[model samples]
Target: MRKQRDIIKQLTDRELNVQLIISQFSLVFLSIILSYILFDSFVDWLNYFKLSYYDIVYYGAASGLLIVIIDLVFMYIFPKKYYDDGGINQRIFRDRSVGGIFLLALLVAIAEELLFRGVIQTTFGYLVASIVFALIHFRYLKKPVLFVSILFVSFYIGYIFVLTENLLVTIMAHFIIDFTLGLVIRFQKRGANNE
Candidate 1:
């Protein structure tokens, strides 16, 4: 573990960005292939992407705004607590462009939602899927508050999937939260650097 952390710590910002993009795309491709092989219908597994435009707009906006608000409240209440470690800031947000951040967040949101909500939740049900999602985000385990936040977000995403039966809704919501957060972090890092 120490060696792995050392290697990660040594990576330059561009190298880390490349690594993140490749890994996220790999996850997306592998999840689709595995879902197809296991379920015999990747489209079905994806909830057929059946949402209407209105559904997409509504849920996307609503969920996105809700999550941003929640995040803001959390940050306000525990300003130093959340980002005190600075590991993510140094690795992911350092010197990242807005476009780069958006692309990274979009890829991550799509890949994670497809695997966790579209495939796992549909297969294993909400409770198990939520737990699995939380567990995979093991970095947050040391921070119980963040861990619980992830669990809640996972369950919320799962619930949206259940309600809409459309992977697009969850995907959009995930993208919004990720993209918004990414932008916030990137700008904050920029501001800090300027200071």
Candidate 2:
């Protein structure tokens, strides 16, 4: 564990960003491959992209906002240490411009939802998919609070996907949550600097 933390501590922001990009795109590729193998046709995976504006607003965007609110409440209530994951998340967003952050968030949301919800959940059902989703967030494993938080969030997002049956809704929700939190990390740094 000590050696692992040491390795993580040595990673530069650029390296971390590159890793994030690679991981997300890899997931996207894996999703495509799995979908093709598991389903009848290559285009079948695209069915998950079906969009209903009403569901997007109600289930995706609204739930995203609610999760953000809940996160904020927890941030206020808990010690910052409980949320810490060796500062990897803050490093990923802190130095990025708003546009960069938005792009990163969008990429992550689409790629992850493509795999976790659109493919995995659709294949194996919600429980297995949600567990896999939460487990994939390996950085949070060392922090009990953050791990539990992610578990609950994964289940919540999976539930919404089940309800809407649209990947766009989950993608929107994921995008909003990640984008908002990225902004918070970025601005929080700026605010501290201005102090």
* Whole-model lDDT per candidate: 0.77, 0.90
After superposition, which runs of candidate 2 have C-alpha atoms over 4 Å from their true positions? 1-5
- Tens digit of per-residue lDDT, candidate 2, span 1-195: 564446756877777778779989999999889998888887777777776899999999999999999998998899999998887777778889999999999999999999999889998999999999999888788889899989988999999998988999999999999999999999999999999
Q: Which has the greatest lDDT? A: 2
TM-score computed on alpha carbons, candidate 2: 0.94
After superposing candidate 1 on the true structure, give the runs of residues whose Cα lies further than 4 Å from its correct spot: 3-5
Clashes of each: 0, 0
- Give per-residue CA lDDT, model 1, range 51-152, as digits (tens): 588777787658877988897788789866764433664467556788877877788988888888777777788898889988987778877778878888
How much does each candidate deviate from the true structure in C-alpha RMSD? 2.0, 1.5
Let me know the TM-score candidate 1 reaches against the reference structure: 0.90
lDDT of the structure predicted as candidate 2: 0.90
lDDT of 2 at 193: 98
